[model samples]
Target: MYVPVSLLFFFIGTALFVYYKTQPGLLPETVTGDQVFPYFIVNGLPAGFTGLLIAAIFAAGMSTVSTSINSSATVVLTDFFNVTSHSEADEKRKMNILHATSVILGALGVGVGLAMMSVKSALDAWWSMAAIFSGGMLGLFFLGYIARGIKGSYAFVGVICGVLLIAWMSLSRQTVFHNYLTIVLGTLVIFTVGMLLAIAGSRLKKGN
Candidate 1:
């Protein structure tokens, strides 16, 4: 689904760019790639249709925002509260906590969104942050999936090393790695280190 959708979107975007470029005085040199679509929607489309499109955009944004807030709240409930199937009173308490978490997370999301207004490109900022956070997560997943008989200490060490590499790659301006490669490299590092440690441990045990 994503592949076809991405292909179609690419073609459509290509057509839009061609249309804008071929037309004289339609697009200004100062306009950026991020602003191109919004510029077209506001300047090219009819006012009523533009309003409808903007409303739809808001609707889509709200949908994703709600999903993120809900998911984050659920994670907090599971990880922090350790909520499980229990008595009715406990269930109710869990529900209340979830609600409170959702509200707090929603406020934080709004604050972060407002803070990001000064960024030149929202997408770039989002990708950078996503890469930084997702690296550790992906590394842990890879370590669990690929490693067998790896001790908890080995897994922890691998995850810590992967996280440090990701931080270095993201925070150090002199690093050559791209923002998107952080997750990939981090995952590989975790898996490789964990597997090697597990193998070494097994060999040492046999030798002893």
Candidate 2:
């Protein structure tokens, strides 16, 4: 558990940051942490850890851009076009919607990167934010797909709790390595709320 968690920080954490930098308006500023920290503190290394970090960052940024573009394309084709299901709109309308969505997603990504400037530590901020944002998606999967007849309301509530707790932690200045608190808090909220919603949704379904 400990090793895996540590790896997540060293790997996933670094990757997320690199992704952020790749976005427009979020490029690196002066000689900050990334520039200051040597690959190996004790001894210099060639083609070393800094190289690895740079590679990881590019991979992350490229991956995000690729996936977001793909998802947007799929959504336009399937949802707006109703391609396989049905094509309600004409080609022009569908094309317009796809373009609009692409612009929106790009704008939103820039906004998120800008917002991240206020975060105290890069790793801590990323982990905590990821936990808070992803909990609801995870809850939706558990409630809608994995569990039978789970209520959407319960999932919403769980997400709310997760946000509140994370926000409180953010304000309180509680710092722990590996961001264990955020993960534990987020998972607990998601699991509890999902279970409750599943129970309630089941009861409601049975009653009606």
Candidate 3:
């Protein structure tokens, strides 16, 4: 599945590149990533294929939105509500909470979407923001899985450090690496720092 999808993307990208090279005057210098697909659909595709492409785009968007809502609701229920509760809640109550959480999240997502309507490059902005958000999460997961014997306290510290580093890297727009690589750098920082702290703490405890 992954390979096929990747090949599809490669072909599509190559086609787009060829189109742009052949018709440089069609698009402005300030054209964004979001404009590429719509332009292709409107200009490149025939009448018969255009509608199909539009439907496919809508379906893909709907699929992503549905998946995001479902995942958010699951996380809220399992991680936040379930963990905080002392006993098993009533099924009806749980369902209500889940629904409420989904509604709130949907509203928040809409608000954010509206706020970002004027963004120059939606793809770039989305990737950058996603990298920042995923940094601490992926870092902690890596720390736990790879760094055996790391204490929870050290792990927490590592997450904090990783988040701070990510913030600095993002704010400074450091050219040391590309924006997408920030997440990888953040994860490495968290794992390295957490492991070092854990080992140092263990040694200090043994000395005492």
Name the best candidate (by TM-score): 3
- The list of candidate 2 runs beyond 4 A from truth reads 1-32, 37-63, 76-87, 117-120, 136-156, 167-179, 194-208
lDDT of 3 by residue, 91-163 (tens): 9998998899889989998998997888877756766676677779988988888876788899999988998
| Candidate 1 lDDT, 140-168, residue by residue in tens | 77667766556899888888888788878
Which stretches of candidate 3 lie above 4 Å from their native place?
1-7, 28-32, 136-146, 171-181
Q: For residues 25-77, could you state the per-residue lDDT of candidate 2 as single tens digits?
A: 44345535543233222123355765776788789888979698769776877
Total colliding residue pairs, candidate 1 = 0
**Best prediction by lDDT:** 3
Give the winner by TM-score: 1 or 3.
3
For model 2, where is the 10-residue window of minimal lDDT? 35-44
lDDT of each: 0.82, 0.65, 0.84
**Residue 195, model 1, lDDT:** 80
Clashing pairs in 2: none
Question: What are the candidates' C-alpha RMSDs?
Answer: 3.3, 9.1, 2.9
Q: How large an RMSD does model 2 have?
A: 9.1
Q: How many pairs collide in each candidate, listed in order?
A: 0, 0, 0
